[model samples]
Target: MLKIKLSIFFCFLLSFCFAQRELALKYETRLHTYLTFKGSLSPFIKITETDARVYKSNQDKLNDNPEFIIAYDEIKTFEQLVKNAPNDSIEAILKRKGKTKWSKKTKSEIQILYENEDRDASENKPLSGKRILIDPGHIAGNFEMSVIEQKYLRFVKDSVPNLPVDSIHISEGILTFATAQILKKQLEEQGALVWLTRDDNKTSFGITYQKWLSTRKQIVLDSLLECGAMEKTKYNKLKKEDEKTFFWSFFRDHELANRVKVINKHKPDLTIIIHYNVDEKNTDWLRPTDKNFCMAFVPGGMNVDALKGINGKANVLRLLLTDDFPLSEKISDLTVKEFSKQLENQVAKKTDADYLKDNCISSSKQGVFCRNLALCRLVKSPLVYGECLYQDNKNEYLELSKADKTYYGINTNTRVKAVSDAYFNAIMQFYKK
Candidate 1:
């Protein structure tokens, strides 16, 4: 009796101690955190049940509290940013205009028709047929002595640069720039008028958000980061008025204002902004039994198909760009299906994969995905944000980087060609429809 009582007392003390700790972290309005897990740390929390998965598939018992935990090492928490940020990161990132604005000027350079490689003759080739708008994304810094004061005021005195720290690597500008280049080449070949959002060189990287919001700056400090991790110092350099710039900028620059300007100017029938993805639950791709770099996103809008308003944003307009090829590979139209199917054959000839198993197409790391977020939601036009792959994983990065493309890492021609082929086929289908 005495021994049993002492054992029970010991167990109670351990349970009491374990219950004292909880996953306490903060999330602001638009901020998020993703945790990576490999083992059964599931025994810890009851609320995190859905995110937990067991290995070997034969476990009679499940780990309620996972042995380990992971979360995003955010330099700037969204709430801190929202509270003190000068401009909204999202908005500033997708800004339509630059700090140094330009007058509307048209330069008549040698232009080629979609069908023929030859430059357009001095003869008037007024754009007939469908017009398309392609936004490449991002600009580089400038070195003009005249505008130095203006630029310095923004970076030095401005509240936030929207996406601070590493704009060169994971920013929207670089990825969009790549996708736009491939898209432009392909769309032009098919004879569509594609007006890109940015250019290849630094001359058109757009104005830094830092400059735009220099007039009003606010600072945000992260209490969680380690020593010499300048998150706190970087936070204080901004003024107050830049609060809503992030969200507003993305809408205005990427979706509404910038796109509207292009549409009003040229009246494109289609518009697309290519992008990649980041998913924390990426073990399948990261530690793969095979090499498969795959993911997809859907268009956002109301649906007669289902009546769920969980993530509905009215999708604003009937965006037809969502249904554009390279954006969607599900292939609804017969003509496009046939066209893309043939292209799959070409892809198989050059690439090594069991293409037939995936219905002659496979954008999955393993099998088919039911929710293709980048392709489905379109309030205005048929628009979908086609994601290349996850950037955070090493294997997927290696596979996705197999192209002749290189951001910070070198890739082979095959990988680059594969992504190019997918988008190209997607475009061909849109025109066919």
Candidate 2:
């Protein structure tokens, strides 16, 4: 009885001390402490190495600053950071300049932001003043320009079995960019501020495939040497190694990192990733089969590689601090609904787990699911990654392949317009309430 009382007292003391030092605590220590609550940690607070961050998820309410980020140089192991923090209590910390502004707001207003339940949908110009970022998946271009979304292109052959692989026809990069362009124009027309991650079919990384391979070798060597990891004399030997290492490790990975940086910089209220799905049954994209589907992704599918480096740690922190997942899921549900409605009951049903490895998670809606896709997981905003329609469906293939018709500066089939319209309507419906 005495020991139980002592334990309870000790836990209370620890909690009090933590609350006092929370503001000044190191990122890792604070995250660890915050994650101690069993109920609070469920469905969130993941610590995976998906993008290379120390901590992976966050929980920020309206008017609440995300995490108190210490300078990189000041960041230390949990013990080291907490050891030297001043003995200011939580109340005292709130009194400090530029600190705990959340306390200044009305409790009711804060509650409103937290719940955000009674927020009304706008009738006209619903998206006005909203900042939106559009990321078109893949690095694609005209047939002669060389395709860079190698992952998706390869999947085309592997998705369908026993199909003779021929010349690449449909490119996810090109199609997505085209879709993004249309969406951007429509959103802007609705009074929303919009931006695209990439301007053209090539890449947002500032280099094409030809130039990336040719010039990246020396650049990688210079980076290694500049970071004091390589000696001048060893440049020749390391250059050969870096040639292969740079492409996958730095080049490909860094491209995604760069995109994340820009998206965070813009601080969009929402991020919409445009992608076209493919039928796993139809590998031969030249002749599309009847299989089709529509789905969208929110965050939460984190795996081992999520917390790999500094950006990965930052990504995890951003995800943890922001209260965006619920909203992301809501918008994705709306998008799936709007797309299904637009497709006239042609939406893909829940896929079979035996064939589709990424089976749909249980949700209020049919097609929408939380996936751990890179853009879906990394972007620090309400994100909806829409796999609008299946490009491998025979009807969709013909519709998508109708490139002779021109709309909004790119030659696209009427189907592309329909896809874009579905997205526009979904966004409008989501925001208009």
Candidate 3:
């Protein structure tokens, strides 16, 4: 009887060990972890000889639970991972290899998850050590400033031409800055380290429009030279080129490059870009339209064309080996939910218009989308580019024009406050304990 009992106990132990190993292998093979570059794994976690660096959320707690680290020669397509499977299942093969590599190219990837990822170390302040970056879209200034900066103020002149009724010179730079300022205050209140791409309406890149105006293009030209975008030998020749030629190729790219550099320098965990939407059908945007909607953009929708610049290959690798896209999408969904909820609750009136997409709406409930925009593609961190509401919508225009109108307990302009609240709520909810 004693001998029989010992045999049954050994069988149970073996079964439990196999089950734990299967679970570990499944966890390691997931695509989400592979996409995060330089991301940390648990201190004692091990990977198969075919693995690369593992990425962990900076917010995740240290956990060394995985039992079996599946190896692969190189992370290829899903089809490739399964193509060479023998009669024994892929999971079984991984178990049999026991960390041995069939090919010379296979090498184990290592990362150590530190203890600091847990932001909730303190009881009250959840986001104490977290860094958040906010970027307001576009740059606009007075007429001369606009000319100097080569970015015009987006104005919807009243159809009557002289009357400013239903007219708005919606300087996107101004609106976004206002939104960012509001968000910064809220985030700071919540114990977050907040940084804005630009402090005010002026562009963060190069000299201010006012300064440039006084210098008469010399300031900008000097900036281009200082930034290495222009060569000293070709200075005179390139400076004389037509506005369109110089502005599009060299000047625009130089400015964008500066913004990207600043963002990467900060190395913030998340980036939020704020903007107001305008109706595309109404080219003039002269009259208020009945249409209005909110949407959020994440990184994706890239082709080979998008991969042509110096950062192109790097960007491709980031998309493939980083969690930026998934993280962006997750934040975007939260943003959409919060913004839509706030709009519905705070708006004086409700409109029939809601979420709309250029292509087929993938799901009736999804409000976040992938757009291959320069900022979305280039920014290193997870980004949520938000277009809160239509500026040209009849009611929305009036709401945007209002000053100090209270809505949903907020004292700012209804539209601006609503948009700000949406973002605030989203962030709070996303980072809630």
Identify the leading candidate in terms of TM-score: 2
Score residue 321 of candidate 3 by CA lDDT. 42
lDDT of 2 by residue, 32-111 (tens): 43222223333333322211122224433233332333232222221121221222321132123121223324333333
The runs of at least 3 residues in candidate 1 whose Cα sits more than 4 Å from the true structure, single-residue gaps closed, are 1-128, 137-172, 200-206, 214-238, 241-266, 282-295, 301-379, 399-414
Provide C-alpha RMSD values for all models, in order. 22.9, 11.4, 11.7
TM-score of each: 0.38, 0.64, 0.63
**Per-residue lDDT of candidate 3, residues 80-133 (tens digit):** 222222213444533444434434332221111111133433535766777788
Clashing pairs in 3: 35-321, 35-322, 39-55
**How many pairs of residues collide in each model?**
72, 28, 3
The candidate with the higher lDDT, 2 or 3, is 2
Q: Any runs in candidate 2 off by more than 4 Å, and if so which?
A: 1-124, 144-148, 151-168, 214-217, 225-250, 284-286, 304-321, 345-350, 353-360
Give lDDT per model, in order: 0.33, 0.59, 0.57
